[model samples]
Target: MSPLPRFGRIADGPPAPAGGGESFATLLAAGGARVERIASLAQADPPGAWYDQPGDEFVLLLQGAARLGFAGGEERALAPGDWVVIPAGCRHRVAWTDPARETLWLAVHLPPIAGRGAIADQ
Candidate 1:
């Protein structure tokens, strides 16, 4: 087995959103794993977009708060230190961000699952 590589602090820039306002920063990208730091508007209410990925995403809130709007019309509030697991192929988007402060998030994307099974189980 190959040894895991070590990385220091990673600085990310804004994400380019297809919509009017959205941005993100990519912190780490190696093989099937990717970590990103995101910052965005605090009062923007955007519709949930239909998007899919091959890998599952794990998001952790580092600062501020926001709401996630799922494709099924479900909304969930996320605060600092809050974490959520987003399954692959789930359509979602950021519905709201706290206007009081910048929303910081740590998102990790893992390799895609194979054979219609969970990636973690493999």
Candidate 2:
């Protein structure tokens, strides 16, 4: 058959896993970058928790809405078509997500870009 159709709906997936823990599925990986589909069902970082990733991450909010809190004490709200980049070594957390709807996200992870600053800082 021809190359597998690289196609599917972003929101296509079984209902968010029970317990509402955010679910992440990698869709592609190549060289030094990868893509994923993340679904968050009314979830937020655990009490006082944060993420300190080893690589940079760029995420686009495709459905519902979300709030991202950075270690620098700033919280950014994201809506459909909105995107943000978290530079490697940056500390951040999911502050909130629309609990009444399914929050769908397309996320890309890549090796740190030399001398790049957190997109939220600009």
Candidate 3:
């Protein structure tokens, strides 16, 4: 037996953030892996704030544009169709996002692999 199919649109639910914030929608979850849709509108992390996750994150820019900043001072600009895999323990933060329009992102959180701190190319 298998689970039933699930369908959804990233923009189907939740309006853009009012004022300044981000909206998250969980699309799937199995075991320790999860998929999410993140909608951002004129939102960014507070100064000096960084996200250091215990697991790896694969993110794709679905719509709009944004920039990511790393703890080492490297910044990467993202546009539609752009994707990046952030390894566990990598300090990062959202530096900028399209403020005039909604910025949509598809993020996949991968279960942490013991003894590995980075993701290798397949």
Global lDDT of each model? 0.73, 0.83, 0.90
lDDT (Cα, tens digit) per residue for candidate 3, span 1-122: 99798777777867567786799988889889999999998878987999999899999999999999999899999999999999999999999898999999999999989999888778
- In model 1, where do residues sit more than 4 Å from their true spots? 1-20, 43-45, 117-122
Please provide TM-scores, in order, for all candidate models, with all chains considered together.
0.73, 0.83, 0.93
Residue 57 lDDT in candidate 3 = 98
Candidate 2's residue-wise lDDT over 1-122, tens digit each?
68766877776755566667588888889888899899887889875698888788999999889999988789999999999888888899999988878788899998655666444466
Q: Which candidate should be chosen as best, given lDDT against the real structure?
A: 3
Better of 1 and 2 by lDDT: 2
TM-score of 1: 0.73
Q: Alpha carbon lDDT of residue 17, candidate 1? A: 48
- Colliding pairs, model 3: none
Error of 3 at 115 (Å): 1.4
TM-score, ranked from best to worst: 3, 2, 1
Which lDDT value does model 1 have at 11?
31
lDDT of 1 by residue, 6-121 (tens): 66553345633434344666777989789888775554554545556677899998777888888778989998889988888777778887765667788899888676534454
